[model samples]
Target: MQDKIYFIELNEDKKYEDYKQYHSLLPLEKQQKIHKFRYDIDKKLSLIADLFIRFLICQNLKLNNKEITFEKNPFGKPYLLGNPEFHFNISHTRNAIAIGISGNPIGVDIEKIKCADLKIAKRFFSSNELEYILTNKEDSFFYEIWTKKEAYIKWDGRGLSIPLDSFDVTGGPIDKMLRMVTIHGYIISVCSRQDFNGAWCMELAEDSVPVCLQKIL
Candidate 1:
C-alpha cells in the first residue's frame, strides 16, 4: 500500500493515562469492549484500533472527538455516517495499528511474522493458491496470501460469511488492487478500488503533530 493507508505505532510503555484518555473518546460500547480484555496486549490493541480511527476521522474531517459518529452496515462493516463519501478500515497487530481511507471501499490488515499452520491453509486456500504457497517462500508466502485474503474479505465487508476457500489468492480481479508493505518485519496489505497510494508513516499516538514517519519500509 502506498498512500491511502495511514499507520500509527504506539509505545506500550507510554503513559497509560494517554491511552485511557483516547479510549474514553470512543463510544461507550467500544470502551466497554476494551475494558473487558483480560490481557494488556489485547486491551491496548483494541484501544489503539479505536484511537486510530478516531484520530484519522478527526484530522480529515476537522471534527472534534465527540463530533465523530459511526454506524456499521448490516454485515457489521463500520463506516462514517455523516460523510458517506469516505470509506475506511482498521487493523491491529500486537504492537502497531493501521487505518485506511479512500473515496471508495477499502480494507487493510497487518500480521506479525510468525509460525505457520499449513494445515489451516490447506483447508482454506484453493488448490492453485496452495500450490503457490507450497512451492514458494513458505512462511512468507503463506502470510502474503493470508494478509491478502484478509484484506479482500474486509473489503468485501461480509466478514467470514464468505468462504475463504472459494476465492483464488494467487491472483484475481481482487488481487489487482491489493498491495503489500513490509514494515518492522510485519506484513501489511491493503485493498482499494483504485491503485493504492497509502501514506505510511510512524505516527505515534502521543505525537500531537502529524509528520511523515521515517524508518518504515
Candidate 2:
C-alpha cells in the first residue's frame, strides 16, 4: 500500500460561501467546530480541513464518506478509529491543508514561510537545530526545521510533553523516514515509519476541495 499526501489550498481572498457544497457532507461535530471560529478564514479552513481529510479517507480506504470515524490518542493526535490499518494526520496553515496517509503511523505539517522571531528557535530547538536555522538566515530554512519538528512530534503521538530540545532532529533515527517538500510558498514536512523516498505531490484543491474530489480519486 502506498502512502499518500493530499493538498488543499484556501487562499485569503476566497470566501467560505464558495465552498458551501462541502458543508452538507461534514458531520455535526465538524460543522460545529467550523462555526466555532470567529473569523471567516478560520471557519473556511476548519470546514475545508475536516471535509478534505474525510474525503481522502473515503477514497483511500474505499469506504463511504459517512463511514469514516476518528479517535484521538491521549495526547490529542487523531487516528482512524474504525479502520486502524489506515493511519492519517492533518495540518492546516494560513493557506493550505495537508493530509498524510499510510498503513503505518504517520504525521504531516505545512507552514507558510514567513519572518518570525528567531529567539523561538533558541528556546525549543536543539543546539544543532538552532545552529542550522541561525546559520542559514533564510525563512524557508527556519520553516523547514520547524515543520520537521512539528511533524515528528505528531508522529510520536505525544504532544508537547516531549520537549523539543531533548531530541536530535538534524540526524533522525534510521528506521523512520523524514521528508520535506515545497507547496506554493509553504514548507511541508512529514514523518512516518514506512520507507518514503520523498515522492509526494501538492496540487491546489481550490474549487475542487468539496465538489471535484470524487473525480480526483
Candidate 3:
C-alpha cells in the first residue's frame, strides 16, 4: 500500500464559524454532556474540533452514514474502532491543525510559536540540543526545537507524560520523508511509517475544498 500523509491548515476565523455549525449538528444531550465547561466559547470550540475531525475521517474513509467510533489505547492514544489496519493522528494549536494518515501507525503535531522563556529548553532537550540552540544565536530557535520534540512525543503515543529529553533527534534530518512546514507563525510536522519522498505542503484555505478519498490506504 502507498502511505502518504496530507497536511490541512485551518483558517482560525473560519474554524470558529465551522465550530458554530458543528454545535448545531450535535444532539442537545450530547452537547451538554461534552460541554461541561462554564465558558460557552470553550465548550463550542471543543465540540467543533471533535466534529471537524470526525467529518474528516468519515470523508477520508468514504463511509456512507456509518458513524466512526474511536477507541482509546491504554496509554490514552485514540484509534479507530475495528479498523486497526488504518492508522491516524491529529494535533492542533491555537491557529493551526494537522491530520496524519497511514496504512500503519502515524503521529502528527502542530504548534503556534509564542513567547516562552528560553530556560524551559533545559527541561525537555538534551544537553547537546540545548548547546546547539545556544550556538544557533537566535532566541526563537528554542520554540522550533520544542515543537519538533513535542511532535515526536505525540508520534510516540505517550503524549506529554513522556520526558521530552529522553529521545534525541539531533542527527542529520530527523526523517527522510518527514515534512516540516510553517504558516501564520506556526510549525507543523507529520511522521509516518511510509516515506513521503516528494510531498508538498497544502493549506486549508477558506475557499479551498476537501478531497474525497476512494478508500483508506
Candidate 4:
C-alpha cells in the first residue's frame, strides 16, 4: 500500500469546548488521558492526535472504530492491537500535528520554525550535522535536520534511547529513506523503511477535519 502522511493545522481560535465534541470517539483510557492535560491546547492536541490516527486506521483497514484498539511498545510507540503489518507514527508542535501510516514502518515529525539555538544543536547533534547547520547558518536548516533526527529516532522505534548524535541525517544511505518539506513556517520530515516518493506530505485543511472524524465518530 502507498504510504499516507498528513498534517492538520490547529485552529487556535477554536476553544477546547469545540473540540470536546469529539470526545465520544475516544476510548475511556484516551478520554481520561485528555482530561489530565492542564491547558486547552494540550487537551486538543491529545484529543485530535488520538482520534485522527484512529480515523485513519479505520479507513485503511475497513474496520469499525469500536474494533480498533491501541497498545504501546516498551519505548512508547503505539501500534494497532491486531494489525502487525500496519505501522504509523505521530508528532505535534504548537500548531500542527502530523501522522504517517504505511504497511511498512513509518515515522513523521512536524515543528514550528523558531530561532535556532546552536547550543542545543551542539548538545544533541552529531559533529557532521552541527557543521552543516553552522556552515549554512540558517534556522530553516537547523529545523530541517532537527525534524529528520526526531523522525529518524521515532522511525527507529527506540525513541530517545538511541542518541541523536549517533546518526547523521545528512546525505547518505539513510538520507535516501527520508523526505522533508517546509510549510507555513513549519518544517516536516518523514522517514520510511523504503524510500519516499513525490509529495508524500499532505496538508489537511481545518474544514476537512469533521469529514474525517465522521468516518469513525
> How many clashing pairs in candidate 3?
0
lDDT of 2: 0.79
Candidate 3: stretches off by over 4 Å: 1-21, 24-30, 37-45, 172-178, 206-217
Model 2 lDDT at residue 115: 92
Question: Across residues 50-146, which tens digit of lDDT does each residue of candidate 3 receive?
Answer: 5555565666676542456677887888898877777877776554556666776777767776675667877768887788788886655666677
Please, what is the whole-model Cα lDDT of each candidate in the order they appear? Answer: 0.74, 0.79, 0.61, 0.87
Q: How many residue pairs clash in all the candidates, one count each?
A: 7, 0, 0, 0
TM-score, candidate number 3: 0.76
- The alpha-carbon RMSD values of the candidates against the true structure, listed in the order shown, are 4.6, 2.3, 4.4, 1.2
Off by over 4 Å in 1: 1-3, 15-18, 198-217
Q: How many backbone clashes does candidate 4 have?
A: 0
Error of 1 at 178 (Å): 0.8
At residue 110, candidate 3 shows an lDDT of 73
Error of 2 at 210 (Å): 2.9
**Residue range 131-184, candidate 1, lDDT tens digits:** 898888558788888888999999999978899999885777877978888777
Output candidate 2 Cα RMSD. Answer: 2.3
Model 1 clashing residue pairs (backbone): 2-197, 2-198, 3-197, 3-198, 3-199, 4-197, 4-198
Question: How close to the true structure is residue 20 of candidate 3, measured as C-alpha lDDT?
Answer: 44
List pairs with backbone clashes in candidate 3: none
Residue 131, candidate 4: alpha-carbon lDDT: 96
